[model samples]
Target: MPRSMTLLVLLAGAFLIAGAAALWLERGNAMLLDLSSSVSSFMCL
Candidate 1:
């Protein structure tokens, strides 16, 4: 394979992995935030 093609493929793979990781982290953070908010509301009452 040509050098440019190889580099493109590697970059594409990195981008895919990064995107997946970002999505996973974002979901976890959202869940944590929701849980914290609920707990705070319960404590206030």
Candidate 2:
């Protein structure tokens, strides 16, 4: 049980890291046009 829990934790961490990296790489283009031009803002803020 402990081993499986550890593996699950490691997998979760790896997925999180991978997702963060992907988002960082695509940050410049992400959500660029999701909103209307009048409502668009930097970082969607």
lDDT of the candidates, in the order given: 0.97, 0.77
Off by over 4 Å in 1: 30-45
TM-score, candidate number 1 = 0.60
Estimate the TM-score of every prediction: 0.60, 0.56
Among the numbered candidates, top lDDT falls to 1
Worst 10 residues of 1 by lDDT: 24-33
- Highest TM-score among the candidates is held by which one? 1
With candidate 2 superimposed using the best TM-score fit, by how many Å does residue 16's alpha carbon deviate from the native? 0.4
Q: Go through the candidates in order and give the C-alpha RMSD of each one to the true structure.
A: 4.0, 6.5
